[model samples]
Target: MSANKAVGIATVVMVLCAWAYIALSREPRLPTSIANGRYSNGCCGTIFLHDGVMTVANQRVDYIIERDKAGPYVLPTAYVGASVHAVVVKFDAYPLKLRLDDAAHPHQLELLDDAADGVRYSFTRVNGS
Candidate 1:
């Protein structure tokens, strides 16, 4: 075979090998309580979680939740560092549970009774459609 043809065949083989590895070794995806997307309570401005960091915003103030991955998402309680209106506050292990209304829809996060910095509310994902 020509050098160009040999390189093309080798590239296809390598791609197939990588794809097979990913397809076979994939772990069962566990549902996460902390979703990485934009969420809204229909009252507050918006809430966003990207790459383990969170931002809480409203009409008046915007709070910053620091990068915290020290806790587990299994339990109903989680603790993290938060800054509410420039004042640092510790969210002392509050209840953070996930309520899945149906399998056809995304899970609804239920943060009951002041989960973080007096922001006690349940929020769902913002539908792009």
Candidate 2:
């Protein structure tokens, strides 16, 4: 094969290998159960995590959630640095991070502000949800 042909083949093979690796080793998916169902602060508003989508606000916005990843990544400094499902949402007020507290039982969650030193709320599941 000509030098150019050899180089072209090598490039295609490398690209295919890289793509395969990324596809095979993608981040683990978030559990729908942990954040699923109806949740509320009983003060500000409600959060719905149903059908693999999250829409939460005092006002109501259907936000599509993607890039759900396990953590140590999004956990606040106060946390014990354990791994759990975490996702970030961009809100009108501010960006927020939601972290699952318990992976075993998967009931409560932590809603944290975007601020480096920010407030965190323990959001609980509403009854019969």
Candidate 3:
């Protein structure tokens, strides 16, 4: 083949490879199976997510996601917790961060921070919740 034709083919191949890599490597949405349900924390408080709305202590908190820092990342793998798998979700109200308990429980949020320093909540999945 001509040198020009060969170079053109090579360039196209490189571009295609780079595009594929970028598309596949982008961060993924939080898994619904792990994000959906009711998690109880404290003596009588609960954090519930149904159809995308999160309810905490009977107050409905919507997903924030785009006030500049896009989030609500329920990544099955840790996004911000570092050691323990956690999600940096942006909510309309409190508890903007969440971490999982362990690999043993897939459908659970181990802990949450209320954005107020020293105020944290730990939770476990309520049966059938």
Candidate 4:
């Protein structure tokens, strides 16, 4: 093949590789198995779960949870209660199948896991009900 043709082919290949990387390496979305929302146990305080980041009292911790699986999983950065495993448990008669607990009692929240600050948190929601 002509040298110029070879170079053109190489460029095309490089571009294709880059496109594939950008497309495939994009971060996965928070699993559908988890509801996205703001949760509060009232006394325990409030937490926001969105886009794979858990914000507790305004401090954000990036995390990943595989769909329908439990975690001893690692977060993207260090978080107070980094050591925890999570699974989506079914709760009764609630639209949020992945929610921490029954939403009927707004004052109550369950501490599915403990973070570095020693606070119990249940994060994995996109918005409030």
In the range 1-129, model 4's lDDT, one tens digit per residue, is 999999999999999999999888734444522534566443345555566776665566555533223322323334333124432222231222222343222222345333336434554322344
TM-score, prediction 3: 0.49
The TM-scores of all predictions, comma-separated, are 0.36, 0.48, 0.49, 0.36
Q: For model 1, how does the per-residue alpha-carbon lDDT over 1-129 read when each residue is reduced to its tens digit?
A: 899999999999999999999888733333443455665555433555544455553212222221213322322223322222221223554423333233334433333333234554455677751
Model 2 over residues 43-121: C-alpha lDDT tens digits? 4455666644555432334332223445511222122111123323434343334666555444665676444665665
What TM-score does model 2 achieve against the real structure? 0.48
Best by lDDT: 2
> TM-score: which candidate is best?
3
- Model 2 ranges with Cα > 4 A deviation: 1-24, 58-97, 114-116
Task: Give candidate 3 misplaced runs (Cα > 4 Å).
Answer: 1-5, 16-26, 30-34, 64-97, 100-105, 115-121
Query: What tens-digit string does per-residue lDDT give for candidate 3 at 1-129?
Result: 999999999999999999999888744444344556787654535667664566654455553211113333332222221112222333332343455544323455644442335344466678876
Q: Each candidate: what lDDT?
A: 0.43, 0.51, 0.50, 0.45
Q: Which residue pairs in model 3 clash with each other?
A: 30-74
The superposed Cα distance between candidate 2 and the true structure at residue 112, in angstroms, equals: 1.2
Model 4: ten consecutive residues of lowest lDDT: 88-97
Q: Return the TM-score for candidate 1, rounded to 2 decimals.
A: 0.36
Cα error, residue 107 of model 2, in Å, equals 1.4
- Counting clashing residue pairs in each candidate, in order, gives 0, 0, 1, 13
